[model samples]
Target chain A: MSNLMTNYYEAAAVILFGIGFMNLLLAKNLIKKFIGLNIMDTAVYLFLAAKGYITARAAPIIAQGTAARVEDYINPVPSGLVLTGIVVSVSVTAFSLALVQRLYKHYGSLDLDEIMKKAKKEEKV
Target chain B: MTAVNYIQNIPFFSIFLAIFGGIVTPVLGNGKTAQKVNLVIVTVIGILSAVLLVHLWQREESFTFMMGRFPAPWGNELRAGPLEALLALCFCLVMALTLTGGSRFLQKDVLPGKQNLYFTMIYLLLGSMLTLIYTNDIFTAYVFLEINTIAFCAIIMAKGSGESIVATLHYLVICLLGSGLFLIGISLLYSITGHLLMENIQQAILDLVQTGEYAFVFAVVIGMIIIGISVKSAVFPFHFMLVSAHSVATPASSGILSGLVLKSFIFLNIKMFYCVFTIDLIRSLKITNVLFVFGLMGMVVGSISALKERRIKHMLAYSSAAQIGYIYMGLGLGNHEGMVAACFHILAHAITKAMLCICAGGLIEASEGNVGINSLRGAGHRNLVAGIGFTVGGLSMIGIPLTAGFISKLYFATATIYSPQKMVITLLTLAISMILNAMYFIPSAIAIWSPVDKKAKIPKPSRAMQYAIGIFIVLNVVLGIYYAPIIDMIEIGIQLLES
Candidate 1:
C-alpha cells in the first residue's frame, strides 16, 4: 500500500511538471505563468517529501522519555531540504509579484506581447 | 590536517560582523546617516577580511567550520578552504571599491529617501555572496542564493525607473525558472544519494561509477546539475534575460551584478563540478567538450552583439557575456594552468568592468542621460578623469599588454595550446574576435579622449566624481602591473583543489 502511494505521488509530480511546462510555453498571461511555476514547485516539494518516507516508521522527532530508534524513523534530510526549498520558492514568489506590480505600472498592461511591442517602439524612437 | 585544525577555530567573526552590520543598517539609522554608517562598516569588514585572507595565505591552512559547535557530515558547515578565502577577499575588495567608486553618483541625485534601503540591500547582497561561497551544504547554498536574488531584485527596484521595473520583472521570471530547475535537480540528487553532504555524495557516486551499477541514473543526475548551473551562470541558451536585466539596472547595481553576482554563480558551478563530481566522471561525461563549444560560441556571439549595440550599457552587458565565456573556456580546459587563468580573469574582469560601468554612470549623469556613442562625441575633454577611467578599462578589456586582462587571456590561450583537444586553433580564432571588441570599444574611448565638440557642451563632473574615477584608474594600472601577489594566491588556491 505504501509503495502504491509512493508511485501515485511520483505520477502526480510528473503530471504537474508537464502542466507547468505547458503553461509556461502556452500561456500569454504573466501571472498565469507564475501560477504554473508555483504549481510545479509544489510538485517538487511533494516528491521530495515522499522520497524521505519509510514504511512503518514514525516521524523523525523523538517522543518524550523514549529512547531514539534510528530504524523506525524516516529520513529527515529530504524534509529539511524541502523546508528550505519551500522558503526559497516563497521568496521568489514574493519578489516576482513585486516585479509584476511594477511591470503593470510601467507598461500599463500585463500582457507580455504588448509590453514587448511598446518597448521595441520606444527603442526605435 | 594539523594545519587545518589550527586555522579551523580562528572563527569567521569578520564575516559575521559584515553580515550582521548589513542586516541592521536600515534599523539603526536614518537615510542620511545610514549610508555613511553602512559604508564605514562595510569598509571595516573589507579590511578585516583582507587581513584574515592574508593570514590564511601565510599559514597555508584550509578547513570547514561547523556553526554552533555542530559536527560536520550532519550539522551546517562553513567551509573556508583556500578558494573560499580567496573569493571572500575578492568580494570584500570589490565591494569597497564599488562603494567608493559609486559614492559620487549616489550623492549627486539623492533620490529623496531610499538611501537606507539601498545600503541595506548592498550589505545583504555582499553577505549573501559570502555565505554562498562559504557554505558546504547544497541546501544552505540555495538559501543564500535566494537571499542574493531577492536582494538584487530589490536593488533594481530601488532605482524606480519604468525601464528598470520592466527589466526586473523579466529577470524575476527567468530567475524563478532557473531556481525551480535547480531545486528539482537538488531533490533528485537527495533522493538518489540519501546524503546531504557533498563530499559523501561525491564518494558514493564515485563508488557507484566504479562499480558500474547505476550508469544511467548517474548520467541523469550529472546532466541535471550541469543544466541547473548553466542557467544560473547565464550560459548560452539561457542568456536572454541577462542583457536587458543588467543593462537597465542602476550603474552601482550593474557593478555588483556583473562583478560579484554572476561570479557567485560561477563559484558555485566550480564547486559543483570540481568538488562534487570527481575528475574522471567529468571527463568521461564529455562535459568539458560541451563547455568548450558553448564558451567559444558565447565569445563570438557576445562580441558580435556588443559590436552591433548602440547603447553603452547594453554593449557593456554583452561584453560581460563574452568575458564569462573566457572564464568558462578556461575551466573547460580542466588543468591547473586553466584554473589559475580562470581565477585571474575573474579578478581582472570584475575590477575592469566595475570601473567602466561607474565611469559610464558618471558620463550619463554629466550629460543628463544623453549618452549614446554618437551623443558622447567630444565629451572626453570635458571630464578627463572619467575619460581616463574608460580608456584604461577599455584597454584592459581588449587585453592589451601590461594590463591584468592581458595576462589572464594569455594564460588561458596558452592552456588551450596544452589541451589534448588542440584547442589552440579555437583560441586563435577567438583572439581575432578581439578586433571586433576594439572596433566597438575604440570609438567610445576616442570620444572620451577627443576634444570637446562646441555643439555638445557637456559639463564636467564634480570633484567627488573626479576622485572616484581616479581611484579606479589607479586600481586598474597598479593591479595590472603588480599582479604577482594575486597570481601567487591563486596558485595556492589551485593547489587546494588538487589536494
Candidate 2:
C-alpha cells in the first residue's frame, strides 16, 4: 500500500514535468512560460516530499505535551527545503512577470517575433 | 543555537553591510541625491571588504560560521577559508572598479528617473554573488542564485529600451528553468540524504556509493546539478540566452554580469565538483570527459560567433562566452595544476573583461552609440587614454605576453599536456582561436588608433571615469608582472579545497 502511494506521487511528478517542459517549449508569451516553470517546480517539490515519506508515519509535528518520536514521523527536511524552493520560485516568477510588463510597455507588443523585428528596424534606423 | 557572534566575524559583517546598503539605496537616494548616496555607500562597502580581506589574510587557519548556531549536520554554515576569502576579495575589488567605472555610462545611458533603481540593483547583484560564494548550504546558494537572477532582470530593464526589455524576459525564462533544475537536483539529494548541509550530503553520497544501492541515482542527480549550473554559467548550448541579454543590457550591467555574476556560478561549480563529490565518484561516472567535450565546443563556437559579430558590444559578449569556456576546460582537467589554473584564470578574466567592457562603454558614449567596428575609425587619434586602455585590454584578451591573460592561458595549456588528447586539441584550438580573436580585434584596434579622421573632436571623460580606468589598467599590468603572489595565494586556496 505504501509503495502504491509512492508510485502515484512519482507519476504525478512526471506529469507535471511533462506539462512544464511542453509549455516552456511551446509557449511564446513570456508570462505563460513562467507559469509553466512554476508548475515544473511544484512537480519537483512533490517528488521530494514523496521520497521522504515512510509507512505508518505521522506528520513531522509534535503532539501537545509530547516529545517528538523520530521512528513514527515523516522526514521533515525535504518539506523545509520545499518551503525555501517555493519562495525562490515565486520570487523569480514575480520578477519575470514584472519584466514582461515592462517589455510590453516598451515594445507595445507581447509577441516575441514582433519585438525582435522592431528592435532590428531600430538598429538599422 | 548559540548567541549571535556578529562582532567576531568581520567578513560576515562586511557582507551584510554591503547587502543592506544595496537594499536601502533606493530609499535613500533620488535624483542628484541618489548619485551622492550611491558613491558613499559603494565606497564604504568597498573599504569594508578590503578591511575584511586584510583581517582574513592575517589569520593562520580557516574559519567557519554556523548560521543561527545550527550544528554542522542540521544547520547552514559559512566557511571562509583561503579560497573563499580570495574570491570574496576579488568580488569586492571588482565591485569597487565597476561601480566607479559605471558612473559615466549610467549617466549617459540609464533613464534619469531610474538611477536609484539602477544603483540598488547593482548592489543587490554584488550582495547575492558574495553570499553565493560564502554559503555552505546548497539551498541557500539556490536562494542567492535566484536573487541574482531577479536583480539582473531589473538591471536590464533600467536600460529602458524595447530590446533590453525583451532580452531581459528571455534571460528570465532561461534562468527560471535553470533554477528549477537546480532545485530538483538539490531536492533529490536532500531526500536521499535527509540533510541539507553540504558536508552532510557529501558524506551521505559517499555512504550510498559504499552500499552500492543508489549509484545510478547518484550519478543522475549529479548530472542534473551540473546541467543546472552550466545553464546558469551560460556554457555551450545554454549560451544563447546570454548573448542577447548581455549585448542588449546597459553597458554597466553587462560589465557586472560578465565580470562577476557568471564567475559566482563557476565558483559554485568548483565547490560542488571538487568538495561535494569525491574523486572516486567523479572518475567512476566519467563526468570529466563530458565536461571537457562541452568546454571544447563552447570555445570553438564562442570564438566563431565572436568573429562574426559586427557590433562592439556583441563581439565582447561573445568573447566573454569563449573565455568562460577556457575556464571550464581548466576545471575539467581536474588535477592540481588544472584547478590552480582555473582559479588564476577566474581572477585574470574578471579584471580584463571588466576593463574591456568599461572601455567599450566609454567609446560608445564618446561616439554617441556609434559603436560598430567601422565607426571606431580615428578614435585613437582622438582620445589617447581611452584608446590605449582599449588596446591594452584587447591585447590581454588575445593572450599576448606581459598580460594577465597570457599567464593563465600558459598554465591551462601546461596542465592540459598531462592528458595527451586534451593537450593536443586544446593547444591547437586555442592557437587557432587566438588568431581568430586577432582577426576581429585587430581591425577594431587599428580603426580606433588610426588617423582616418584627424579633424574630429574627441570627447574627454570626466575625472571620475579617468580615475576608474586608470586603476584597472595599473592593476592589470601590475598583476600580470607579479603573478607569483597571486598564484601562491591560489595554491593556498586549492589546498583548502582539498582539505
Top TM-score model: 2
Q: Give the Å error, residue B137, model 1.
A: 0.8
- TM per candidate comes to 0.93, 0.94
lDDT of 2 by residue, B205-299 (tens): 88888889777878888888877887889888778778888888766678778888889999998888866776557757877777777777888
> lDDT of each structure?
0.75, 0.78
Error of 2 at B101 (Å): 1.4
Per-residue lDDT of model 1, residues B99-137, tens digit only: 666776655433557777778888888878887777777
Cα lDDT for residue B183, candidate 2:
78
Q: Estimate candidate 2's alpha-carbon lDDT, on a 0 to 1 scale.
A: 0.78
Which ranges in model 1 have alpha carbons more than 4 Å from their true place?
A1-8, A21-26, A122-125, B1-11, B28-30, B107-111, B453-460
